[model samples]
Target: MRHPHPLPPPGHAEVRIVAATPEAARLIAEALRRRFAATEQRSYPAGGEGGTRLHLTVDTTHTAAAPRPWPATGEASGARRLQADEI
Candidate 1:
């Protein structure tokens, strides 16, 4: 099995985009490519779940969201869009 937390090769950075749709993921990747100059990208199907995400490898430092928040106690009322520092 693939390691859950694989490190990027030296001098490269990885960025993951978890979105509700493949188009959303592609848009995010395109935006990042314009800004960060990503060198590589791959999209992964999230199995039975209804979303997709893209992993981008860039030649620069990448920032990730802070640790995810504790699970909500009940059904989610609405989507939560969070920033990197507000994870």
Candidate 2:
């Protein structure tokens, strides 16, 4: 069967994320969103067993190239560092 939303030419790709629940599928898709320029996700039922299938297209040529570096020791960013005892 033909996919309803076909990926645009060469630089784009189709990504499918399948999981036992919609929330689980979305969590993975959310992680992809942080690393690339992607389309909004579309979800569908995977099967009779209640799984979720999510689809989205990502632009390979466009990405989050410069992610912010982690603040050294948290104190550098004025955030308090959690002490091991807090855990």
Candidate 3:
């Protein structure tokens, strides 16, 4: 007899990376935009400073299994697994 598969955990992993310059920040945003189906970008001012802040958001639902579907491409699949070294 086959055993039933365990239920996958709830929730998702949120990845955030802050940079010093707009250029560097955009680089990350662009990368995420190319990979994730749902990506968003927002700008905010840095308090007591002149430079602005960039926020990049990526939805990882496509990469989750069970209740969710897997990514169509390998590039998108790779984005799901975040290495400890990358953190």
Candidate lDDT (C-alpha), each: 0.73, 0.84, 0.56
In model 1, which residue pairs have backbone atoms overlapping below 3 Å? none
Task: Show where candidate 2 strays beyond 4 Å.
Answer: 1-7, 65-87
Judged by lDDT, which candidate is best? 2
Cα displacement (angstroms), candidate 2, residue 73, comes to 15
Q: How accurate locally is residue 42 in candidate 3, as Cα lDDT from 0 to 100?
A: 79
Pairs that collide in candidate 3 are none
RMSD, one per candidate, in order? 9.7, 6.8, 14.9
- Give a tens-digit lDDT track for model 3, residues 1-87: 665854333433344556767776677776666656334677676556655577644566553223434455455423467657777
Off by over 4 Å in 1: 1-6, 9-11, 61-87
- What's the TM-score of each model vs. the native? 0.54, 0.67, 0.44
